[model samples]
Target chain A: MKTQTSRRTLLKKGLGSAAAAIFLRAKTARSHNIKRYPNSCGVLVDMTRCIGCRSCEAACNAEQKLPSPALPFDDRSLFAQGRHGSKRRTDENHFTVINRYDPPEIDHPLFRKIQCNHCQEPACLSSCFVNAYTKTPEGAVIYNPDVCVGCRTCMIACPFYIPAFRYSSALHPQIVKCQFCYETRLKNNLLPACVEACPQEALLFGKREKLIKIARHRIRNDRDRYVDHIYGEYEAGGTSWLYLSSVEFDQVGFDTTIPHEPILNSVKNFLAMVPMVLTIWPPLFAGFHLLAARRARAEKTRQENNREKADEDV
Target chain B: MKMFNPENVHLPVSGSKKNDGSPWSFQDKVLLGLTPRQYLSQLCRNRVNWLLVLIFGVGIPLIVQRYFYGLAAVTHGSNDYPWGLFLGFGLFGMVPLSASGFLLGTTVTLFGRKDFHPIERLALLNGLLGYFFAVVYLLVDLGMPWRLAYPMFVSLGPAAVLFLVAWHVATYLSVQIAELLPALFEWLNRPAWKHYIAKISLGLTIAGIILSTLHQGALGALFTYAPTKIHPLWLSTDFQWIHFLCSAVFGGLSMVIISSFLISRYASWRCGKEFSSTLHDITLGLGKGASYAVFTYLVIKIVAIAHDNEWEYLLTAWGGYFLLEIAIGVVIPLILFARGVRRGSVTTVRWAAAIAVIGIIWNRLNVAIYCFNYQLYQEVPHWKEVWLTVTLYALYFIVYRFIVYRLPIVFTWNKQSRKP
Candidate 1:
């Protein structure tokens, strides 16, 4: 197992047996279409249209039944608040937040609403050991509190830093994040409360395939008003939510440096070696032991033979 | 310094009779053959004990309060920084240092390097305590400490990196215990049990190597998930596992060297002639291994940089911090170890090893806390949280000292069942 798990020992023996369903489905999906995701859903946010009303935040809090915010949602002063050089981000209490980004080149400050990107290959789902996270066909990244062991690996794995642990809860602590309203809205064919409550018609709900086209259409037609890129089209292997900003995505607090590939791509190199280590290390080390033992026995016999011959000669 | 006349020392073991000819009891063993009053007086004589008492006086209740009032009472538990010192220093820092167990086990048992046999048991004990304490740290850091076993038995997410860590650590902990069982059995005067373990020692050692390799590297791979969160210089996606695994090699060796130095200085009374006399040579030998490992780690770290094409980031402030870590932790130790080994200076090697050990902790801290969320506000550890970590380490110290004092780790056993 030691040698096999090295770069060699990658397979999880227990998991291989227990949860073959997920793997089987993945394989089936791969066989059907090698290039694209099948029937995935998505959302597109138009920053040019956003009024920074905070109605989405208010609606999300009411729908999720989360604790009330420290200040009322109507307070415009929250946009000025920044910490550690960054704007206010999503936390346990607030699943989604709008941060005011002042790009000097642009006349108006951009209001960037940050939440779970709900990637095609969600890092939280991949990194979870208990399989607590699921990427729904409707483009929602849902979390199961029942199976969550609260290791908080998901929080660390997420490229967007979307997930948060309810550390304050001692007895029944679990991960807190936007599930894209998977349970109360998305699953029921209704729009996420945040999307429905957007007063400026900024949040557009549609199939992930169509959202890409819509984002490109807006950028392609209005070249000067919008940046030429869609924020989540390929970032972290494409997310359910696509964004079109007037200025650069980084100017509006988006992590522009995220890789085009999924987060798992980085870890797969090491994981691939685990099986190799497990398979090769045991026999190789055991062979070394056998050779050493043989040599020691040979030396011992040689010394004993010489001693006996000397005694006979004497 | 007065040389210890280790030849006259009698090691602790079962069936050893007392001066009056009566057999030694378990109570006598626990009390170190001294009366309760004498033991108390001896403990009180040390200033260190007083400090430990002060730490425990405050630390113990805080631990209780954490359980009752929850982790929020003791920790910042910040949403930005989910993992604090408990994991960064305790699990990530300590596990690699404990790699000595497998390295030495493979050296003395699998490869049959009889010269390292004297200090091999010490290496094994160091590994055991490091791992055990790491788990203790995990217990304190985990939000729902009771559900720790969920990754193992209840709802196994075998595909998860943490799941692999949980299984491997638990299994390896057992393997290490088995590898050390001969000594434990010998101390208990159970020759039969010792003989039984001796037959399977090779298997246990091999298991240790396998588990140690994957898990040590897996710990680094854990950070691979947080590509954006961790600073690029600290978090290498391509070579993160290799970087972690390679550093652990030196980290583990350096820890063994540090433990040996401490044992020679503070545990002379417990060491046998063979152990005390040969420690200098062993220290040098271990230094050579560590120097090689550190050099490899440095090269690989550079390779990781090149592979990622991260040269541009080098001009930034985070790059300076990364370079400082390499210079102080890796480069200095590598140079010092190389020089110390060549000069055959035990003191030089000892200092080099100490620096290397500190480097391991520094590197882990950089990854888990310092460089983590570099763009966010730093989460300073709560004073109680820091104290609790200190308390757990003290407990680790006490347990380690107790085991070394009683077991045939530092000392040589005269039992018939004992073997290399």
Candidate 2:
């Protein structure tokens, strides 16, 4: 057999290019880990408590000093507005938006707030080639606009599609998304604008560990009312922003099929092979050249010997 | 090895010269041995020149406006779909088709296939331009075009798939340029420069393979980051990069056939006797290679589906689209190529090559645009975006012609002959 298939060598000889590339990938990125923050604070959101109030959205806009939204904060009419078959996602103008999901036989619609999930292992942080994203000690995923080249790769990498670009600007384009109010609140151990503005007490602020217990306790206490699970406990490797809801996650526009592991885990295998290819492919191809050249030389010598014999006879 | 020369072309291997045995001036070289008046007349006579003028009139302004007014001026400013035709068609679509350089490089230099020497330089040039212009397309799409070095020199996200793509493409572009250095030296008639390149050709060829292997696969690996966003059929974590790399082999080879077909048809003046004589054989060989690659790609695609156990997905409308893609790009081309190779039918092979190129482009577009966020509503790119994409492509064509017109690509330089 031209190719060897012994077990020790597959891992020892390397799965060749793929395994080595993944193995040597991101040697410098060990410092920027998404799992470093265990005691970092997080916000647990209870969907059952929300009343579709526009107060939190208004507070977020005011706190960020963002431009007024196209529709007034008090307007519930925007719930019917959708373009290109999708509802209003967060954009450069707004960091967070709530979508109303009407459950059948229920008198009122369930208002689900959509914002950056602030994943433990964030897709945005991993995908940004410029290292523009920073997963802070306080569990908020912050972005540095100055370094952002605005490739918009973060948008595609994001499972929740949270990162939005300022494509309207020609001179300077920046990615706009929620930072969990890192600068104004989370860093200083204060409540974020949206959390403080929640009149229904739907937003709870605590350590991520405590938030998990709170989520479980709530689900266990209300067996029939709650869906016995925390939405962000493991989705995309556990987002800092956890969710509790009465309805199925899909019905409320949540992407639950996303692998429980971090998005980076999906590509880790390929990255491991990069180093192997860099080291192995060069020598492998060059050795092919050496072998072919040797054969050509041997053939040349044989032909020359035959020609010499004919000349001697003549 | 014998040098390539197409006898059907205008102007012989020798440059236009004075009767006293002096070579033509720089101006004459630029004119491809034609006089100033003759060159102007030739430009005016060609229909392609007129089309170029029309494209420049519309395209240049949009390109300028894109920088002046921002991407929103020339594209449908959709924040949801950050990448449009510029990246989908230009970077992704063009890069794979340009893979011929390394493929041919490894075959000729590494494997010692001397018979394939005649078309190696052309493949190298094609690869160089494809990669160079892919970067050009990237610059146009980047929000901060000036900070392109950020991935390399500035804040580094070495862990990211894009980081690998950026480094590999940048290095590969340089490697491709080095691989074509001998041809450039030959065109300049500097034998010493050509000899210097010959010394390091093996290294350059090896670098080309490693870089091309990674970056081409890295393009697909870029999608692996978005597991939930892209359609499942298009996204295979285990084999996504392999699928891309395998498909690229044929994508690159088929492109050479298509480009050669165009050259044989339209720019016959540039080819020499060797090129003309060898073009048919080379096309057939490339077709055979493409058939094998397409078959391999089809198998791996099925394996990916099986590994993921996504058979039920085939029952959906998306499955029908996937089947259609395979039928057109893989099955039809595979059948035509196998028959064409056996019967020595260059026409069938040519048709198969064209189909394969289209199939590759369609696949890239499907990944980058159509099936991305399949659950979300579809996006029809702004008309301006389409025009801008066409404009960049036209520019690529113009540069290609300009180089082919002067370079020792399809023809070898001959010292014995004097005067054009």
Candidate 3:
């Protein structure tokens, strides 16, 4: 019995070690290749310069050929209107919305525009099961409606809660969000419609690296005018869109709790365990099956031998 | 069924032939060896059938309305909450409950526990149906039900956690079907098919373990993708997968116990003497196994909260809610399971199983819906959405009953009919 137990232990150890070696090799060869594109262009939204003009909103609506709004873009009443004490979010009807926030700390109401940040490693792109989302080299996190199975996992994954499903369409429901005008404008090396439409130069489109330098330079020159920290510099592993604000970003509807790392970082541990389970479970369970089967066979043989000996004695 | 099952009654067909020795046709087997009128009469006699009819009568039209008028017409269709009761209750909730298939498979086949043989097929059927209905719920909730196979065939994203979930679930569903095929082959009188499945049953069981481990964990890993969205108490990125996997151990077993207890009470006539006599011992044995799993799950859940340094979150209102969930869902069930198994009280164990089943579903709902977007306002599901979720569950119950009644899941096939 002692010898049999040792043999079983040895077999289990052998299988475990072999599986570990394969798992280790796979782990090294594939250590989460987080694709970071250089020379990607981005938008720098300096909120101090914006006059709360609805020009960008109207420009986006016309540029995207979206349905006209119930109240015209010039209407200021939309700012006061909200659902569940929440400000207007990007939905299928609207790609980008500039919300007016009246913080008590400051005397004036600060107008903040909300849209997709288009992260360096976009959560939507990472979480999409069909590879429907794409973070192009040009800094746009575009979505392919053709390939989308519409599982809505992307919506759950987005830290900023930007992606909204077009629930009205029974046949062709798809996620609607700001794409930086990737197909019509960014692909042609032109500024996005919203940036081009900003009459006060509040929205600036340039190479992401250059934009970061310019944003830093502006903060260094005028410390009192803008917050020292750039909103998207490292949020969610650095979005393509950066923000300079007068007050703390959270006071004006920003999600301050977003981690500095990419959303994929949260899931990487489980993803790492996947290969190990796929590699090890089969051999481990099979070894158990073999041991149990062998023990059962041995018990049967021993019972038969004892019965035969008793019969001879009789 | 009880009213219909007389001592000399020829209904509730257990074998391929009548007592007079004429072979029952396929139709007769489906009707349980009763005439069409008798079958309809028996169905109408049961009050449960009337309840089922009422649910489906309202539910089927709502389901059709959902597809025709779009999700916005039925559900709140809020952009903030992309998933509602359907995925929360149906997919996440049902998948864990379905884990009984692999757990029992590993026990009876891998560990060679022949005493559990009587309940193995029933567990497998439960697992299979739970998973099958989860997909049905997916089909209903998904925006594009037509493209369900795209993840499998058209395109692939191997790096995503959901990709792993999709592939493993699809593969595991087939593995479960193959594992349960022997019972179907026995009912169909195809000895050849049964023999072939038996030869490869070990491989299939091993495959079941591999797929079940990855996907069950993957379901929890799905929440990890939204670390900031879900409350800290519910979301521990490092331990989320293990939390899901560990809890499923008891969740699946508890579901089996609940189903088995219900069957013993309501459908005793369907159970053979062997199944009926051994059921009490089997319940005790299963209760013991479930208690150990619940103990492990409770420990890990505490360990997760500690590892994430989330004790501070417990002091808030959310913390109070979290503690309530732990006490009612985890602690109460664990204590009941332990006490029940120790005292040899099957009734107490059954009660524990029932609470555990509801508790597990409640936990899944909390993680997916209630605690999700913790800072944001809660998104209440529409009444139509709730109706649809309950409707799908009723459909699941019906499918389960239909199969258990017809298949040799609760009872052994008569040996005399094996050759014929």
The CAPRI category of model 1 is medium
Q: What is the DockQ of candidate 2?
A: 0.70
Candidate 3 local lDDT, B252-319, one digit each (tens): 99999999988889888899778899988898888889889888988888898999888998999999
- Model 2, position B57, has a per-residue lDDT of 94
Instruction: Determine which window of 10 residues in candidate 1 chain A has minimal summed lDDT.
Output: A1-10
- Per-residue CA lDDT of model 1 for B1-420, tens digit only, reads 012233213223323454334555777767766658756877888778899999999999999988787778888877778888889889999999999999999989998889999999999999989998999999988778888888887887787788889999999988888888878876776767787788888889998989998999899999999888899899888788888889999999999898888877886777788898888888899999999999999999898899889999888988888899999999999999999999999888889999999999999999999999987777788898889989988999999988987888887655442221
Q: Please, what are the lDDT tens digits per residue for candidate 2 over residues B307-347?
A: 99999998999999888888998889889989999999999
- After superposing candidate 1 on the true structure, give the runs of residues whose Cα lies further than 4 Å from its correct spot: A1-37, B1-15, B19-21, B414-420
Best-matching candidate per lDDT: 3
**TM-score of the A chain in model 1:** 0.88
Each prediction's DockQ? 0.54, 0.70, 0.73
- Sort by lDDT, best first: what order? 3, 2, 1
Q: What is the Cα-based TM-score of model 2?
A: 0.93
TM per candidate comes to 0.92, 0.93, 0.95
| lDDT of candidate 1 at residue B129, scale 0 to 100 | 90
Model 1 residue B51 lDDT score: 93
